[model samples]
Target: MAATSSLFSLSFAPSRRRSIPLSRSANPSSAPSDLSSKPQLIELEFLGPKAGGDGSSPVDRVTAISGEKLLRNIMLENKIELYAAYGKVMNCGGRGSCGTCIVEIIDGKELLNERTNTELRYLKKKPESWRLACQTIVGNKENSGKVVVQRMPQWKK
Candidate 1:
């Protein structure tokens, strides 16, 4: 009972917001910093389970510009295969209608755009980490300049 009362009192305590000016926040050093540097590039890693069930993983690397191309395009250009049936058929053709190109976001959840109506419909029962590669666009400053993803580990029939 005493612990609960103290918890309640703490919850009611006033909040202190420490706001720092944007310029100071960006430059922590006493000396002025260079402002003309280019934006940092992101390293995108794509991996998959190797065939023959050997438990080996093959990884592909690609540089990314946040908020640019869709994930499928990047994977295609970089030769990363998130779907087994890729290049075999239309496979929704980046339409986000089919969930065949699902990939698991190992990191950088906030970098991708919001889910589309098609993704919302198809991915209802899937885990939050799962997203349609065709529907996801990688690259965002909020992701610490990197994004990592893997092919979905399992398929649902």
Candidate 2:
């Protein structure tokens, strides 16, 4: 019985993901085993200083750290929680879907995940600086996409 259980465990256990070298040397966009490029917990103030949020005035640009806790930061800052839109209307919840929880990529685009057909469709409709929250999962394991998100005024829930 123990041997059988051991075998079952071995088979069922999740396999570690392997990282492969980038085929195109021009832009070696490799998916590393570790998210080393991600930040640790970037804070993106929604309203900005003028609105009494934080940071310099003229708030409007999005912010993020490569490995930061995105959702926690948003919650801590009292910003709108878009996680609620995941799966139902947005899907991926934070996996990056529905495009409902979209945010402008005010700064870091290189650090984000490559866009999908679904995301591209929405992005094409809007300005180039936008991306879906659920689909933008890049960055640290703790954070969905290591990005600080604020609900777009145009998005309906």
Candidate 3:
């Protein structure tokens, strides 16, 4: 019983605490001013359906920071419609598993990352301009440019 009590006391003993200092920049002016360190603005132009069947506007232009973010996230953040009615209910939530988030790159394809293996498998028969927004990254964190995107129509899918 004494040994058990000692073991219980040892287990309940207070643990040692270590203080960690918060890291902060010594001089804000000394920070690197290189272009790579700055956030690049990526202008996005979203073209809705031509016939306006989905009740969305024809064109929407927005800006995002170039930081290797997914195109789907940028579109969603900017309130741009990226999915159709059916796709809204049956999407993979940016996992690249479902190809419902397809967008046509009207221009500035160079600003996007290369197609992933999932995109290649899913869009093998599709046009080269068609990209899965879930699998598409807008910029490489250093490039600043304008990208024109057209939302894929429901009938096109």
- The best candidate by TM-score is 3
TM-score of 1: 0.65
**Tens digit of per-residue lDDT, candidate 3, span 10-65:** 76664322244433344465445542366888899988856466766488998888
Highest lDDT among the candidates is held by which one? 3
Clashing pairs in 1: 66-139, 67-139
All candidates: TM-score: 0.65, 0.41, 0.75
Model 3 C-alpha lDDT versus the unseen true structure: 0.84
Ranking by lDDT: 3, 1, 2
lDDT of 2 by residue, 73-150 (tens): 443355544444342453444444355566656554555566667778767877666666655544553443324334
Lowest lDDT sum, 10 consecutive residues, model 2, at 47-56
Any runs in candidate 1 off by more than 4 Å, and if so which? 1-37, 50-54, 141-144, 155-157
Position 123, candidate 1: lDDT: 89
TM-score result, candidate 2: 0.41
lDDT of 1 by residue, 1-157 (tens): 9999998877766432234345543655733554444455567877664443565566778887766778889988877776776534758778876678888888877778887787889889988888888888776543536677777655422
Q: Rate the local accuracy (lDDT) of all candidates.
A: 0.72, 0.50, 0.84
**1 or 2: which has the higher lDDT?**
1
